[model samples]
Target: MSSRISTTRVHEAGIETLQKRQVELAGAQERLTSGKRVAKASDDPAAAARAERALAGEMRAQTSERAVEASRTAMSLSETAMGDVVELLQQAREAMVAAGNASYTDNERRGLAEKLTSIRQQLLSVANRTDGAGSFLFGGQGAGSAPFVDAAGGVQYRGIAGERRTEPATDLPLTINGDGVFMTSLTGNGVFQTSAAAGVTQAWIDNGQVSDPSALTGSTYTLQFSIAAGATTYAVLENGLPTAVTAAPYVSGRDITVDGQTFRISGAPASGDQFTVQPSTATLSVFDTLDRAIGQLGTPSRTAAQIAQGNTDALRDLDQSMSQLQGARAAAGEMLVRIDSETGRLADQKLANQSERSRAEDLDMTDAISKFQNLQTGYDAALKSYSMVQRLSLFQYLNT
Candidate 1:
C-alpha cells in the first residue's frame, strides 16, 4: 500500500522547518555578540548557576583583599609608632646615665632631668599616635580620643586592654595593647627589688640578684643592723620573722645572702638601719620610672650613696620598660608577616574564582565563530529549499 500526503501538510511542514532554522541562527548570533555560552539561566541552567556562584566568590575575595590592605596599613603604622617609642626611651636612658655622673653638679643633674622630661612628653605622643585615619595605633580595642593621658600621678592608658581586628575571612589585628606596653612593666630587676629603709641616711642598698632560683620563697625580707660595743652586726628576717643569721658580723660592701637572695649594703650603716627586699611586681610604668629618676636627680643635698642607689634602680626599671616595648614591637612585626601571607592567599583565591566563572559561562571564541557560520549556511539552505517547495504547484507540474 502507498501512503497519500496532502498539499496543505507539505507546505506547513516546510514552513516549520524554515522557522526552526531561523531560531537556531538567531541563537548563534546572540552567543557570538555577547561572547557568553550561557547568557541567561534558561540557556543552560547548570552552567548559569555555577557562574553565579563563582561570581559571588570572586566578589567576596575582592572584599577580603581590601580588608587585608586596611589591616596592613594600620599594623604598619602601629609598628612604626612602637619603634619611635623604643628610640625615645633609649634617649631617656642615656640622659639618666649622664645624670649619674658624680662630677656633674646639682645644676647639671637638673639639666639632664629636663631632657628626660622632654623625652617623656615625646613618648606620650607616640603612645597616642593615630593611624592617619583618626584611629590610634595603640588604642587597643577602640578610643574616641587619645589613649594615653598624662595625669598628676603619671601617664595613664585610658584605652581598653585588647586589640582591634579586621573583618574578613582572614582575621588580623589592627592595633596593639597600650597598657601592656606603656603601663604594666616589671619593677626593679624583674626578679626582686632591694631598697634601704626610709630616713636611714647612712645606708644604701643595691638591686638584689637571685642567688638560687630553687630556694626563692617570693617572700619579703629585711636586713636589720645593730652596733654592740663598737662591733657592728646584722640580722636577717624573712617576712618579719628572724632567720638564723641573727647578730652576724656586719661588713660594708659585702654580699648579704638571705633566703637565696644576694645584695650589697655599702657605707657605714648605723644601729637600727634596715634594708628591705621584695618580689618584683608589674606595677611600674615607663613614664613613672622616668619621673622618679628625674625627681631624684633634681633633688639637692643627696649623698653619694643615695645618688648611686637612685641610678641603679632607675637603670633597672628602664631596662625592663625597654624589654616590654621591644616585645610589643616584635608582635607587630609578626602581624605584618601574617598580613603578607594572607594577601598571597587571597590573590590565589581571586584568580581561582575568576577562572571558575570563565569556564562556566565564557565562550571559546574560535569554536563560537565556526558554529555561527555553520548555522548561517544551514539557514540559507533552508530558505532556498522553502522557496522551491512553495512553487511546486499542481498546475505548474502538469504544464512542465
Candidate 2:
C-alpha cells in the first residue's frame, strides 16, 4: 500500500509527464514559427531528396536558357551585318551600271571606281563582324583574327571552310562560313579570264560573259579568221564541225554577232588565226569581280564594247552575291525562330520543376497552426495537474 501511493514516486511521475508535454509544446511552436515541414533531411529524408533533385534540374535548365539567349543575340547580329552587306553590294552594283554609260568621261568613271574601292573596304569590315565577346562570327573555328585578308592584290579567306556551333545547343549552327558569304566563286568553266591566241594578239574575249546561262551548250567554239581575196572573214566551228552559217565579213571596231552573243575585235587578225570561246567552270571571288569592275572603270580610253562587257560581268557577279546574302539571312532567321521556341519550352520546364520542389518540402500553414494550438492546450493542463499532485496527501481523494 505505501509503494502504490508513495509521495516520492508520484512526484517523479508528475514531473516526467510535465516535461514531456513541455517538449511537445516547444516543438509545435518551432514548427509554426519556421513554417517549414521539412527544414532538414532528418525531418523528412525522402521529401528532402526529391526537393534537392528538382532544384538541381531547375538550375541546369536555367543555364541552358542563358546559352540559348547568347546564341540568339549572336544570330541577330549576324543578320544585321549581312543586311548591311547586301546594301553595300547594291551600291556597288549601281556604281557599275553608272560606269557603263558611254557619255561618262574617263574622269567620271574614275570617281565611280574610287567609290567601288570604298564599298569593298566596307564589305570587308562587315564580313569581319564579331559577337559581343569579340570572337569573329565568320571565322569558322579559326583564330579570332579577321578571316579575310588583303593578299596578292585581292582578298583571301584565312578561316576554315565551315562554321562553328555553340554548346548546350549543339544542333544549332551559330556561325556562317566566310567563303559562303563573302567569297563565292564564279560558276561554269574556268574561263573567267580571257587571252588572245598566239597569232591573234589583238582579238580577245573582251568583257565576254554568258548573257543567258540556259542558252549555253557548254561546248567549245572556235573562231577561224580567213582572208579571202584581201577581204577578212571568220567562221565559227562547233567542236571542229563548221555549221551551215556562212562566214561573215570581218569589220574592225564592230561587234561580230553569233549564237545570241557578240564579240568585238579591234586589232587586225591574220588568216588562220584561231580564237577559242569556252565557258568558265572555275570559281572567282566576289572581291575579285569588284576589283575588276574598278579596274575597268579606271581604264583610259575603253571603247563602248569594253564598257558594255564590264557592265555585264559586274552586274552578274553582284546578283550572285546578293542571292547568297539572302540565303544566309534566311538561315539566321530560322535559327532565331528555333531559339525562341526552345526558350519557351525551357521556361515551362523550369516552372514545372519549381512546382515539384515546392510540393515536396514547403510547409502547410493551416495544419501547422492547428497542431500548435492542440499541443499548447495539452501542455497547460499537464502543468496544472503536476502542481496539484505535488501538494496532495495520500488520503486527500478518499477524504473528499
lDDT of 1: 0.88
Query: Model 2, 327: alpha-carbon shift in Å?
Result: 0.9
Model 1: runs farther than 4 Å from truth? 1-11, 394-400
In the range 238-325, model 1's lDDT, one tens digit per residue, is 8999889899997888998877888888888889988899999988899899999999988998988788888888888899999999
Model 2 — TM-score against the truth?
0.75
State in Å the error of residue 94, model 1.
0.8
- Residue-by-residue lDDT tens digits, candidate 2, 31-139: 7787767789998999999999999989988888887887788789888998998899999988988887778999999999999999999998888888868777777
TM per candidate = 0.92, 0.75
The CA lDDT of each predicted structure is 0.88, 0.77
